[model samples]
Target: MVIHGREPDWSYVARSVVKVLTVTAALLLTLTVGERALEVFVDVGDRTAQVYGTAARIANPDKRLSHGYTHSGRLPVTTFTMRGEPRRAGPSDGTTEYKIVEGLFGTVQAPLLDGPSGSLADAIDSVEAKPGDGRARATLDGLPPTLVGVGVVEFAHKMTTEQLVAFGRRHKICGGDDVAYIYEPSFYDDSSDPSSLNAIVWNRDMTREDDWAEFAYQCETEPERALAEFRRWVGLLDENDDLEEFELAYGSLKGAADEGVTYGLVFDRWKLADLRKLLDDPDVGTIHLADVAFDLDTWTG
Candidate 1:
């Protein structure tokens, strides 16, 4: 799932864009204005690579990002006598009543290749959606992409910045919600149409804003060490949700230090051997894996 930026509250997904939280008077030290690039160059004995990122703009510190979007589609009218997890996500009057609404913006992109892969919707409903994680991409009818739809998985799933940016390039307009670590796949919509999408623009600019920090640096370390560092980082922010958004969503919290590999485009065709092309193609971006063996551990940059 891609991170759609909020004006002041930029918190989206981890490895996606970051929400610039409110730096209370007591936590001003973490806030700074400087001209240094947030670059990372991982150069262990066996691997070497460069990472480049512009400084995250801390604009409108006093104002939070707006959640303004045109409402589209109809809230699912099919009511159900809620039970299990669905009950908790529904109206909480201690009654077992709930509605299965379309995505925050609306229903799944009309027509379907695989149909509405209810994982994102289910997560929003606080139900545990399984193996059907990742994204569900669809375009209006059989068209080229005046509108595109995607489904982002929850904590027990995987969402990558590369995948998000790939869709952003296909459509000029896009938006997403990162509630409960479950991101509803986003789509592009018209600005003039009040019924069209317009919460956050999902373009390379915003993608850069989300991924710059996460992709900029990574080093070799034991899994336990990396987990400790991540927990500490979350503790420093005192935002446990941030940890969920970043680490838990991808199972990276107790995982090892990442190699920070991301491909320039999104595709399942890539294999571990494909990384050899990185040095051949300067456009390819990544931090070396060294002796750190991995399967198809890559991201679409």
Candidate 2:
């Protein structure tokens, strides 16, 4: 075709051919890209639907998930650097290891349940450890003494590819896609002292001290579920000020200005079997647990 006021010359024809080829190439590229994009979109949608047990894609997928509480600026507890000590001469005396444990935690008990439970109290009293009873308490070492409040510091070891895929499938969080096969999505830091607000989820394979990952998979998948659980806990809170103070300390510690003192909770080996039993339950997904040094002492101070 002739240009505006241009002659129909060989140069014009050549330029027209180039322009036509360029336009045709661009259109083909656009269609190809669009078709490939549609295929990817359908694939992702179908897989996510399968994860959620839905027959179709739901509207507004992004808003529902609690993706790492982007506003919270939370960091991993495992990120805390442990002080390295020279190995002891006598078969590597795990003394320093235990001492560090003592400084951070008095005794590690897998509480039958989280919180100031009579069960936890009884667990403290009934532990089979020889001399760690009344006299033992968490020392002020290894932890920053001036910490104003406590937030949960969790050390979540990685999960196996199979387990992660299964968890994602069961929970409908991710479809075990390679990109989403990460521990970050499941990690949660409940600075809320109650620790009930943020619960611990045991890894199916509890190799690392049995408390592998405290990811809020439930919250990530169903954020409202956490709020509902929080409400239920609030309703259970007694009228006693002491109880309120303790829980309030837990829930609000995250808002503290500086790094507050955070302690640890260790699960005694004896209780692991029972915890595993609970984990096997179809209804139970994750348990509520914390690393904070609540009152582990059963004796008079």
Candidate 3:
């Protein structure tokens, strides 16, 4: 119908149509790939968050109760709820930040202490010792002996796992005859001077001598499992490469993994008087008083 234009240039029109079709197909393919990539990235992040809570709980076995993940602008924030306190950690403006507390008094932050390596006395002081009568009294004046307090009792020297278990059995809490509720064991070796190995938290709430004996058996027969569990949590230490403490912890563990956990034991519920009696034992080192649950019925697991 266009008699003036050289036969309507049919080839040019066909080439133009082909070029448009090719471009449209390429765009659709690119968009599909981009969407899938985005989904994969999000999925990975979600899984990481879930496992992070597990890792955090393991790393701070004595403290952290639970954890979750949220976002601040484009950065990710990990929130951990410990003993009714909420703490958030994340990267902010190229610097790591820990949101411990915010109130009218400004942010109150309790930074992690530097791990110490030195004499036993120096290492003992590294952990903040709660205020209590060094011998038999509770930290508070009105506190009763029935109120169970969690305490950490470090050993004076490395003991065989058998010896350690025997010690717990012998110096059992509650008149020195009842079964002791040992929650975890700190594997420390004096050979690994400067830093001690981390503690290995066992499954809690099983209050029986048989259960403890079984754990001792595992420590003696299956050292590999204990070491693996220790490494799993130690591997997830603060991402800032502040690994000297953890390294020392691991070294102490590995150095004496075969011998026994020499550092101490985390006794779940002990009367202050009972814990004090432990101080009299020649094998016992120092005791650090920790959480105090007032209600006798309160189950500390």
Candidate 4:
């Protein structure tokens, strides 16, 4: 121990100092590395923003086109609102000239022909009779009055259906009656693939009734048979995936039963294009899409 007191080895002291310096240098290097990594992340985020901006600009060359159509000054959404009620065709006067006021999707302003004022039977008569000329003939010849009513209702329903289809197409969402799912375009490799439209059918129905006037008159009268027919149509479409995106609807006169007067369906908005397409397919037949004036404001809400 006394020998150790004689100038403790300076070499050991020098080695300890070297060790501390080495550790300090390594710690400094680590801090520098961490700072560099953070800087890289920031740079990446900025670059991504720039790329997105450029892509958006390129995709929408016209500045005005970015917002798309101004649907009644609002974005389009799914909603149903009565455009207008069928006009009151006065009491059935046999000589009254009943005109097809609004075609299929039209609102009866005042009775066009002499028929019931507020009955489905009158609606049938009005629809059956020639527009303006007063010859009692179905708009689509050979179809019975009941069948014609169903077609009218189908037309109105199809408007809502087609809108849904268009929306699904735009968003690449698979639409059915029940569940619908949409995938972000960013997640897709080939965005054009129809499979990207992932959606499931929930339920659908369309119906028209000869007793619609009775049902209309007695609010409690359930149109079970008509509704069943509609459900059957929906079921058929559901089973066939190809028809899932197709339209469904109906139309009826306000006074079909009473006066034999013609008034357009209460809610008609079916499109002709869709009807044509449906008719072209062998699976479906001579269904007519009635025209109705839709409340643009409600549609866009």
Native-referenced Cα lDDT, model 2: 0.25
Error of 4 at 298 (Å): 7.7
lDDT of each: 0.22, 0.25, 0.40, 0.25
CA RMSD, predictions in order:
25.7, 22.7, 14.0, 25.1
Q: Candidate 1: misplaced stretches above 4 Å?
A: 1-128, 131-157, 176-236, 239-301
lDDT of 1 by residue, 60-82 (tens): 01111221112222332211111
Candidate 1 lDDT (Cα, whole model)? Answer: 0.22
The prediction achieving the highest TM-score against the true structure is 3
What tens digits encode model 3's per-residue C-alpha lDDT throughout 185-234? 43455775643444433222111212235433332223233334444444
Comparing 1 with 4 on lDDT, the higher-scoring candidate is: 4
Q: What CA RMSD would candidate 4 show?
A: 25.1
Question: What are the per-residue Cα lDDT tens digits for candidate 4 across 89-130?
Answer: 122123222111111111112122121123322222223232
Give the Å shift of residue 83 in candidate 3.
Answer: 8.4
Q: Candidates ranked by lDDT, best first?
A: 3, 4, 2, 1
Clash totals, every prediction:
11, 11, 2, 43
Give the range where candidate 4 is weakest over 10 consecutive residues by summed lDDT: 62-71
Q: Predictions ranked by TM-score, top down? A: 3, 2, 1, 4
